[model samples]
Target: MLERNALTFNPGRDQDAQPVGSFTDVRELQQELQGHGIQFLAEADEGTTGPASFIVVDPDGNPVIVDQHV
Candidate 1:
């Protein structure tokens, strides 16, 4: 999971059987990826008052998270 208050990536797995990301600021990371021609598997699903996140794929086609806790 993309923890908004996290630092370095502490590798781990999630309930969905996906590895959790260790970074915050989904949009910033997304921009960085876009600069390199990387596309998101899914975009952030924001709400009027709740959490938001986006999804992308790793080299092995595994889903990675970029999240913001607001």
Candidate 2:
């Protein structure tokens, strides 16, 4: 079966998945989602072990984090 926003396909499995890899694109994604009112939570640093990150509340107020480190 197919899934909306699915980033992975498991031929032998029943469901698809979206892994951290899906968020690895830092620049383009930032621009694309800007219209959605994305907010910055943190900036990326070379000394840091992971990519820059941010947190935004969804329509339901659930925290959604976007990180591009992979």
Candidate 3:
């Protein structure tokens, strides 16, 4: 069961990758996000994930995958 969020963010990784997300400006967004103390755990294309995104750790140590298709 899949539902769309108001923010247009995908709840699941594959579901999120299914739709062409509205984010076209990713570089600045990535930089701005990093400036806020969020460090990238792993880059999307760096390993198994083929998308161009980065991972950030939540306060509880959960890996939040921020994916961008290049």
Segments in model 1 whose C-alpha atoms lie over 4 Å from true places: 1-24, 45-50
Q: Which stretch of 10 consecutive residues in model 1 shows the poorest summed lDDT?
A: 3-12
- Greater TM-score among 1 and 2 belongs to 1
Residues forming the 10-long window of minimal summed lDDT in candidate 3: 4-13
Model 1, 1-70: lDDT tens per residue? Answer: 6534322222233545475565345555556778898877776543333355667777765667665564
Which tens-of-lDDT digit does each residue in 1-70 have in candidate 2? 5322312212212234334333334444555567677664443343454345544455554555555534
Per-residue lDDT tens digits for candidate 3, residues 16-40, read: 3665535443445556776797777
The list of candidate 2 runs beyond 4 A from truth reads 1-24, 36-50
Q: By lDDT, highest first, what's the ranking?
A: 1, 3, 2
Poorest lDDT segment (10 consecutive residues) of candidate 2: 6-15
Compare the candidates by lDDT and give the number of the best one.
Answer: 1
Query: For model 2, what is the error of residue 10's alpha carbon versus the real structure, in angstroms, after optimal superposition?
Result: 19
Q: Spell out the clash pairs found in candidate 1.
A: 1-20
Each candidate's TM vs. the true structure? 0.50, 0.42, 0.49
